[model samples]
Target: MATYIISSFRNHNKHVTYTSLISTSVNHTQILEEFHKFQYMQTKVFVVHGSPSISSRLFSMAKDVGMMSEGYTWIVTSKTTNFLKFMDSKAIESMQGAVGFKSYFPKSSKFHGLKHFMGLKEVDYDGMWAYDAVYALAMAVERLQTKKHVTKLALLDHILRTTFRGLGGEFKFVNERTLLRPIEVKNVIGKGDKRVGFSIVNGEFVKKMGKTNSSTNNGLEHIVFPGGHTSILNHRRLQVNGKKMRILVPVFGGFKNILQMVVDPKTNLSNVSGFCGDVFNVAFNVLNHKVDIEFVPYLFEEGRTFNDLIDKVYYKEFDAAVGDITITSNRSRYVDFTLPYSDMGVGTLVRNADKSIWIFLSPLNADLWFTSAGFFLFLGFVIWVIEHRTNEEFQGSTTQQIGTTLWFAFSTLVYAHREKLESNLSRFVVTVWVFVVLVLTSSYTATLSSLLTVQQIALKGGSVQFQGISPVKAAVYNNVKLNEDVLVELRSADDYAKALRNGRVGAIIDEILYIKSVLALYSRHEFSLVATSSTTNGFGFVFQKGSTLAKDISTQIAKLREDGTLKALEDKWLERQSSIMSNDFPAVSPNILNLYGLRGLFLISGVSMAFALLVSMVYLAREKCQGRSKMEMLRRVSKICPTPSTCTR
Candidate 1:
């Protein structure tokens, strides 16, 4: 902008009487002291850059230079308007009646915009410029994407040719330079600049002021100057200096990266880093001003809250507080808040229950398992005892006899035993044993079904409860219907893990996002998410009630959101949030097969084998005592165990 103005001056009509370069503050002072040298020159209007010192010097000698009078006019560039906020009273005094340029931005309607989302009322010039630049670049890329061997040069060429009606106006390049929109001329009035004129690329000011010579001086009427004087000064100017800014931010937990207090260990001076701080830096940069910001952590010296933080701004205790402070109606009543940069509402988090190693064994109760084994042996022994004396097929050595007895008993469970029962007693026992086996199998299936379905779990009986928070509300939000009776008050966050691990709680539920962060941080540990709840309002920066910075910062945040920077920021941290939620465990019947479940049946089988062995020994001993031949022994056995029909007769 300065080069453009200087070039125009150099190419002016060649009969120039003189040229002046008041470059430095010292030089400006010299020119003001020696104003008489150029006082009578034909060129009365001085087209200069925005220099506070130069403007200060001009104001200091307004009478000598006839600066406030109608004959002399200063046409300055945009740099002067940027320092309007930081300009001292004296600097502003020097700026009286001075017409300065600022990039002009036309406004338009938007939807779900900064104002609606973050609470920003409007977008600034830089925001519009950024919007146009992004839009143009996006169009260029879209056009180039279809081509082969797309290169940066081609992209740049396409961008220069791109035309879009952006927020700032028509975005186009001319003379190999991006075309600048009309620049606004803020007339230096009493302590403020009012939009009195505007200059387009044609370098002609469109006058809006009602005073005279609006045609010559950028084709505008007249402008008001400092000291409430119109085109005239009282020959009085005050000297002033600018000061550094002090910014207040809160030091609290819960919202980590959004805002955090980081004090230098060596200097012990407070500093800050986070999304809030980063966005603030960007906002100021866009404002085209360098502010020496001294970040002061709001030292509450006691437990503080969003309300307390807002109150500090209201009371003028600090310039502004920056953090993930929520902007709510209650908070708004006390202090002003910028537009919200994030979504509204809160959610829940729950610790994933650790899996049990022996969970596979839970299907059947221990008694049922043991009893099934007992029945196995009982059925085995019954058949062996009933058939041993009557049939040769049951006749075997002690070990073989025992093996047969156990095999037949267990085999009956699957209806796979090959040997037929010779005696009616054995057949009756077999039939009953088969029925028992069917009952046991059916019972196991039903028990497993109930366990896996969990259709009737007691919420309160096993749920991890939160202390200092309404368990009923938490449960309701997390989709667990429970009253106080079902809620277990926790001592701390750790208690949730402990109670869940120890089987003291059925489910653990809490703030969902926080739990996700914790789970991500502790990804090595086993955890699970039960559910996330209804939306809770979002967090935002706090400010003194009605603070413009709140609006300004919120506006920048909104821009960031519009450009998808907010989504990127979320993705930045969210990507680090890994999940350890595992569903690899196979679902086995709670009545899973185990040694303990079958121990009772095996024990009964051992005892039955022993009883059979004793009977065999008794029979052998009796035969020996009888001192009879094989035929005699056979005759005695036949009499005791005849055919079923014979026995019935």
Candidate 2:
């Protein structure tokens, strides 16, 4: 029995066949050593058998030995009916019988002979080897690595590439469809007597062990698959002769908050089962259905930047790319892009600042404050006039009246002094108040007014409005600060317009229609138009440049758009955000825009006025301390103060 088992493991069969039966006391090492010799000779048929060893362990040992020896291999398991009875009593005595061995395989005597062998089921072996064989054939054909079966390697190569479903696995060349079959696991069971056993429990092969699968007495579990790991090996057909082609796509980027890098698993772009993966799958389906081509992703490292990856693709190392890439003319000139898969625009990502929408409304921003200030200013001026008008208006000792009037004017400007002085005002003085209010108000308005000699240049303080364009441009302009890429740059509309006028920038970008209109108004003599490429695509496919695939893909893209599929995706990703008032808005209050605009205005005004008053007081005090006449101080004041003129808006 030992000699028979050894012969079985030593390539005794001309055809590749494996049997599970093995005899007790067979030399396992000798069997492996002999098998290795057969493998060196490129012998494809060999059996690996070990008596008293579990089938799994024997197979594993055989695989390792065969791989090292460069040969195709098969494995056979031992069948033992009365395992306890077969336990060598002499060997047990030699080992002092203090130990016992529990085999990982079933101890049923019915599981014997060639029929009960581990790999006797051809299905198991076929599945296990199909993937590897297919991949080997494809690689060999691609590299032209074949023996001279024919006069030239071309005939074999053609055969290899064209042969589909030649192996156990399902295969398709034209459609790029493969047998996506799952591996089945079978559990062996014993029959009534010794010489008969069958696989009883049928289950699918699982990569992971679940909590629900309980332990056996030996605390060991077996993984059984119809086709072992080898079944799903890399089997792909090149199919060069057909019109159909395969395209490679590259992906990159990191979405931190949206999807976790590690925890959520799917958030990582490189994850084959992630969101990006789903996107690739969809793109593949679209491309494959339309043109009978296959889309394979050159999946590699994924991060926030893809410059290095683009370098690879641009060099023709990869076919194309689809992930997060900022589209620009420079990239377009080098590589072709389908319309934009999605929009890439800037948005306000407010952190801690107040974000109220009400602040955006202009009038409500200062209606209350202006009303109160004006009311008090009117009251205070009237009261002051009444108190001193009895003696006569502007007729008091000029020095004292001037100082009092200055204080009244400054106080009214700073605070609501009018509300405090209403009690002192008389009816006749109120008539004079109307003229005073008109004269003072005219000098301060920021209009096309020539009323004030100072000609106040009201620098537009942070109210971004480019009449015809959308807010997205403003947000992008504020965020993007270009460094040194010469072929492309992002600039604000104002900067772009300036550049265009100055003949600095090649082109000014806006909405296509908007830019066209602006360019129409300009003379042809100023700028020569070269080319116009879409920088940000709303909906497009990406493909290899100059390839007819792009045109075909464009048709499909249009189809998807017309059917509202594109719109649905847009709504799903972009427009699906909750209302602005939702919790995701922000923790801070929302009045910051108005507050920012108002606070800046008031701060500048207050500081300027305060400094002017300080300078005036200094000049007066200096004249007095230096014993100069009051006339000198008056001269300085007249030099500093401006004569009022026509008001502007």
Candidate 3:
């Protein structure tokens, strides 16, 4: 009955938490071991089941552990109470003070005499029910004789609706459903179940009905609890009169919003805020309890790591340690931990490559540049040889000839080599050279323009100096590879950024999840992150190794996670979690028509246009001077003048 009530309580929106479920199929030792697995939940409320023998051993075990007291509540079920039919010394000795209820108790005078005559110590409700069922069947058979036909289904239907006032209260079957009956509540005292109270059909336990505060005994005998106590024990809140709970909080810094330590100016009281505190607060509220939490800064004490802080709980220094305390195997050995509330891991924060004036050259490798240069030289050489003798513009002294050859070869780049081809071979070679230059220049100009237009270029290889210590440093080594490997030891994230800006450290290795907050905290858009290392553990509340509050707190945490409270806390503090692990660079598209790329074209056009204007003016002036025919002057201006074979040598 206790198990049913407790289990039903859990189903009522999980009003309670059952930490462990032990089956009777297991051996005696396994059962005890299973019980041992649940530690000090501060307040112990045990629901014992199984036969009298099992209950005897379990109560013996509970008694050995000091669980038999007023602070504890041990309620057994009908099976346990029924096991007490004989009330042997062993059963009574182990179950001296327990509470249980029996389903029914037959109270007929004839049945009572028969029980007494048969050496039966208690009411025979089971016998009475069986006897009633037999008489009812006999009555049905007698009625069957009156009917034309007798059917078992009809008899069963008649039996199902049968009603009577028998040993069991208002014995009735309505549509195959038994009418609701109240279970008698009893206290195990002096080898028998003593009626201390009764459970009503409406689900209320009346310990003493119609009693006031003025009544000394509340109209009931003094009830005894196992281990001989009269007050309820609560494991969560210690035995203080609602005083402030001393919660040992970690003083370490740099977990951006999850935990922050502060001192009240007016009261000088240290307060803890952030996701951890919020989660604890919410969990406590869900459990319908509260503790006046006083954040005690103890992790700040000299010569202490987080393990030492966990030790405080193991030694019962304070109620619990609240912070981003990770749950690990080593830690579990010393102190109990609640279920993990936050997922965390290792990540890296690094300075991106610096952008410089010549950053425009980043798109192409040296091979491409060298190859383009060699190809241009080859084209110039090929054009010079093809145009030298036939074209007049290529005829000059040795130095002039070399200059004109180079000029003729290079000037075809923008279709500005004005000397017309005299030979078809020279025109063919020039046409092909111009086409090659067009493609090369067009591609080069497009690429360079893209490189320049981007306001910021993501830096890479040989520039960043990684700095962090230990497993994180090791993680960085595994996750990131540098061109110039120089890992330095650094302090805080601010130091990391300062180092990057001042050209010191290139990157900082830390938990990626934490570094994300750092990036958002500082708004370091220039920085880049490359993280892949998985974090081994998560944050949880801590408790004494045997503390049962660990189970209760864990249950509440699981509940919080299920109902989105945990997620909401994460969202509240870590709202700006960075996505730098993506490592995506801005997509660079070629800008072919930018003014910088077309500067040479503009210069050449202006110079050529100026020359044409000068020549047209000169031709018009000469025409006016000689009073020559306009058509002759126009032809003179358009004609290509022949070069002297060797420049006046």
Candidate 4:
């Protein structure tokens, strides 16, 4: 059975680590110590092949070493699982959540009758095999008795050729030595076991154990692993045989909150702690098995880059590299990277706009402001023309009339105008005008409020610069279409702040991860994220090419994202620093509303005013022609149309 298991693993290109225990010579402490040594390798699966007594001892030791937990798997061979019914309750409890292989046989009426004859409630595989062996021998001896001369050789030949339907299926031998039997895969539950699937002759899982004979291939049904977990455990490869994995961490001095390495003087061991470190540690802890790791700090020397740190992983000098390493296409050619754990994009950080007294007019562009003013004046004139002859409010002096008109036009902005209209035409005009004013006022108020509370940033057509150790930063800068001569490069987060504040650089452009680090140091009121271009992938952990650990850790990162752990970590570290810059302040321009947007409102107001003026003129002309002839009425209408010369007078 052990050889078969080894061969199966070899077929799949998986490495197998084997160990043996002698029941007579190996003590309990020695076996436990051996299990303890395996912990350093982060072995997630274990296959046990031995007698029931030896398997029980191995399971007990495994539970002691903490291997029989949610993330671990234990598989026992038929030698032990076949006799699980006879094992004690203690031994059975220790093997809970274990997967086992047992010999399979179709039960028949004759098998039940034999059990009843023996007065036994249950019969194990061993008892069934013994019964079949005795029956075969008895039949062979009876056939030999019929022979004239019987010898030991003749008796053996008869036994070998014997074939019959026995309690344990067909009593037949294959190749004169091995039995042709199928194996049933079972999982240990509370003091018992349940069949999960079946393994055929080629070690392939062919069927699931259920009412439906659904065929399966290469895998079993859902398994309840240790701790009653239904999710499959992640299978990770060992970096070194039972040794602590060497991990390289960058010793960043500027953005310590992003990635930092500190050493303890007493123990002389490096301790990695920062936003990146915490994220990596959280993802590592949720893996199927814990790997022992040693953090070695790599101090950034002159001209050293993040690529150098990744090269160490590529060359096998370190098992992995954990930091704020940006995943780029160029770097990905030589090393593998886990899924990004941070926000992805390139952001432009610039100085906040200064508070101006004319900030209220900043929400709408000049064209919109002028268009709105013209509509207001036109509506005021239409109302005055419609009501001046009938309403006393419009019958004042020329100066008073002009003042009233202007007041009415602007008062509609706040819905505080108290003028009453006597004519239906005037009322219609005012109603439509009031609706237009309401919409304009609401939009203006909302925009002005946002501008007042949140600091706005305007990226003028100025020189752009980026600061980072990644070679991809240059590619991102070129993608933004900035002139090479105007590009300035800085080193640390402090440099970015100083350049932006002192007017050394107009705008600093980099990934959102590094831009956020700058925002954390300074007040958000002074600096703001102006624009974001999603031109680059985000930050990720680096590993050697084709390393399985990279895939395993990437899976864990995806889980963290789904379960909200990644967001919680972000809030704990990065979000708290820039909480003032919440969702209210998005990376958009303050001049959002324009003349084109309010064209519909202006059109409605203009049509209403023009209709009011036409109706008012027709009413006045009719009033004048009430007691006159057609010729006199025509003369009066002609008189109403003043000449250009009379206008000068």
Using all chains and alpha carbons, the TM-scores for the candidates as numbered come to: 0.37, 0.30, 0.46, 0.54
Sorting all predicted structures by lDDT, with the top scorer first, yields 4, 3, 1, 2
Judged by lDDT relative to the true structure, which candidate is superior, 1 or 4? 4
Cα error, residue 473 of model 4, in Å, equals 5.6
lDDT per residue (tens digit) for residues 363-421 in model 1: 76676567667767766766776688777767879998888888887877678898776
Q: Would you give me the overall lDDT of model 3?
A: 0.62
For TM-score, the strongest prediction is 4
Q: Write the per-residue lDDT of candidate 3 for residues 1-649, one digit (tens) a residue.
A: 4566667755653334344555546577876665554333343566766676667777777666655654567778877775566657766776766778766553557666667788977654566668678766776676677789878899887766676665554566643754455566778887577887655555565554333333334434567876576444456334333356567887656553667777789998787777787888788667665456678876444556677787777766677888867667777877778888776555455555556787656555665566545545555555455556456777778898778666665677777776766655445555555655676577777677766654322343324433222234544565555433566655455666777677665455565445655666665457655443454455788976555667888999988889888877866876655243342342333433344544464345334434444554565588677766776776665564334444344
List ranges where model 3 is wrong by over 4 Å: 1-66, 69-248, 254-258, 264-269, 274-288, 292-294, 298-321, 325-355, 365-368, 382-471, 481-485, 512-649
Query: For every model in order, what is the number of clashing pairs?
Result: 31, 26, 18, 0
- What shift in Å separates residue 323 of candidate 1 from its native position after superposition? 1.4
| CA displacement after TM-score superposition, residue 192 of candidate 3 (Å) | 7.8
lDDT per model vs. reference: 0.58, 0.37, 0.62, 0.78
The C-alpha stretches of model 2 lying farther than 4 A from their native spots are: 1-239, 242-253, 256-305, 352-387, 391-541, 571-649
Per-residue lDDT tens digits of candidate 2, residues 134-180? Answer: 56457556655455454455644454455433333333233332323
Q: lDDT tens digits, residues 1-649, model 4?
A: 6777788776885546445545645788888777765664455677888899888888887887777877777888899999898899988898989999999977888899988998998888878888889998999999878789889988877788889999977777667655656789999999799887887654467555333445443466777888788665554445334567888988758787788887789997777777888889888877746667799888778888888998887766677899888888888888889999887767778888678999889888899999988888888888788877778887789999988888988888888888887888887888898898888888998899878865665546556667657654576656866667777878788888888878888888887877787887778778887677777888999876656678888998999999998877776767744564543345565565798999998898889899889888888889778746777877776687667576456
- Better model by TM-score, 1 or 4? 4
Which candidate, 3 or 4, would have the higher lDDT against the true structure? 4
